[model samples]
Target: GQQVMQIPQYQHVQEGEDFTTYCNSSTTLSNIQWYKQRPGGHPVFLIQLVKSGEVKKQKRLTFQFGEAKKNSSLHITATQTTDVGTYFCMFSGGYNKLIFGAGTRLAVHP
Candidate 1:
């Protein structure tokens, strides 16, 4: 069995601030995927990192995979009220199954 763990179960920030979340796995991952879920909305895939030490960025958001494939991180710059949501990191466990982290809930205020 595989599991993904995330830090800072919750976060609160004023608009225009920065935020970051981390994910770790007990076992090396084949690949890792990041997702964001808006309030009362389903999760939306953000990015997937497969290669060791891979990094990807989308606008002011950055995603990184550890060289050992056992950890990952996401960073967001300049938070906004619209950014209020839960961010998740997940991994495939084969056999049509997925292991998801506890998730980081971000609350942005104006």
Candidate 2:
């Protein structure tokens, strides 16, 4: 069995502060996907990281994958209330099985 471990189960940040979440997998991943779930809403796909040592940015958000392809991180700079949500890292196993991290819940205060 494979597992993905996510750190900082919960995060509280001031409006304009930075926040980050880390994910590590027991096995090397072919690709990893990030998701965001707003309060009372279902998870929505944010981005996917496929290459080793890859980095991608979307506005104030940045994503990185380890060279070993066993770890990943998401960082949000200048956090805003709009960024308040739960972030999840996921990977697909064979046979269409998808495994998700425990998720990091973020709270932003203005």
Candidate 3:
């Protein structure tokens, strides 16, 4: 079975520090999607890329689409309590059954 593994499952960081999350898949993917969820809120769309070797960034965050589309990574330059949230990456090709990567939950210390 195809599956993605995320490291640290969760992280706790102090303000003004750096944080990172990694996503890896057992099989190649067609496209990957990232999302963020607040403490008590639903996930909000952050970014999505389908092309191979695609990369995107927003402020202190960087996203990468693996050349094989089987893996991806996310990096944050600095950590802030406001950055507290869960990040998820999904890989799917079918119309009805969208496979998703394991999510990484980040926690920032104040």
Candidate number with greatest TM-score: 2
Estimate TM-scores for all models: 0.95, 0.98, 0.90
lDDT tens readout by residue for model 1, 1-93: 778889889999999999999999888999999999998999999999999999999998999999999999999999988889999999997
How do all the candidates rank in terms of TM-score, highest first? 2, 1, 3
lDDT of each: 0.94, 0.97, 0.82
Off by over 4 Å in 3: none
Q: How do the residues 2-97 of candidate 3 rate in per-residue lDDT, one tens digit apiece?
A: 677777688888888888887888778788888888899998889988899999999998999889887788888887787899988776756766
RMSD of each: 0.9, 0.6, 1.3
The stretch of ten residues in a row with the least summed lDDT in candidate 2 is 90-99
lDDT score at residue 96, model 1, on the 0-100 scale: 76
Ranking by lDDT: 2, 1, 3
User: Which portions of model 1 miss their true places by more than 4 Å?
Assistant: none
Residues 11-98 of candidate 2 have per-residue lDDT tens digits of: 9999999999999987899999999999999999999999999999999999999999999999999999999999999998766999
State the weakest 10-residue window (summed lDDT) of model 3: 93-102
Residue 88 lDDT in candidate 1: 97
Give the residue spans of candidate 2 off by over 4 A.
none
Question: Model 2, residue 71: displacement in angstroms?
Answer: 0.3
